[model samples]
Target: MNRYAVIDIGGKQLRVEPGRFYDVRHFTSLQEISRSDVNIKVSINRVLLICHGSEISIGQPWLNDAVVKGRLLHPCFGKKIVIQKIHSKKKKRRSFGYREQLTRFVVDSICLNGRDLKDS
Candidate 1:
């Protein structure tokens, strides 16, 4: 049976599974932790839904009893996005590009109602 959960981070929703790494927008809580070279366990409590085999649980907004634990891997930058503005008659053009700061998070376990589901 596969176990997974949907979590909210930085106002964005992400589907996560145990033992997998995901790149998400960097948050204030992880800023200080990422500066060091140690593996820090991070817990996220904004779980919206969880699925375990045939049993599924959904929350009204969020589940107060559910939590997802993960490790802070590193901080990195996302793909660069370019923006441009041009005026043909005025012969003016402007262009710029930037990358979003992101962090790497690896899900270690998902806990619900005091029961923990760990990665295989």
Candidate 2:
């Protein structure tokens, strides 16, 4: 049996599992923290939903007692995407590109109510 959880961070909902890494939007609160290979973890209280094998719990916006724990792995920028803007018959055009700042995290555990599922 496998367990999974849906967590909300930076205005997005992400499906996460234990022992896996995910690239997400950078959090301003964590940016100032010195990067090190330590236990720099965060407990997110905004869990949207949780599923433990056969049992499932869905929250009304967010679960009050549910929490998702994660560790900061790294901070990086996503691949640059080019944007081209042109005006019809105006001969005015602009080309630019930008990369999104992102953060990587490794899910540590998912606690439902008061119990935590074992991290694999």
Worst 10 residues of 1 by lDDT: 26-35
Q: Write the per-residue lDDT of candidate 1 for residues 7-119, one digit (tens) a residue.
A: 99988999999989999995657545446665678999999999998789999999989999998888878999999999999999999999998888899999999889754
Runs off by more than 4 Å, candidate 2? 31-39
- How far residue 30's Cα lies from its native spot in candidate 1, in Å, is 3.1
User: Residue 110 error for model 2, in Å?
Assistant: 0.7
Q: What is the TM-score of each candidate against the true structure?
A: 0.91, 0.87
Model 2 lDDT tens row, 1-120? 779999888888899999898988856567554555545788888889998888799999888899988888767679999999999899999999999878888988899868888634
Estimate the lDDT of model 2: 0.83
| Residue 60 miss distance in model 1 (angstroms) | 0.7
| Model 1 TM-score (2 dp) | 0.91
Q: How far is candidate 1 from the true structure (C-alpha RMSD, Å)?
A: 1.8
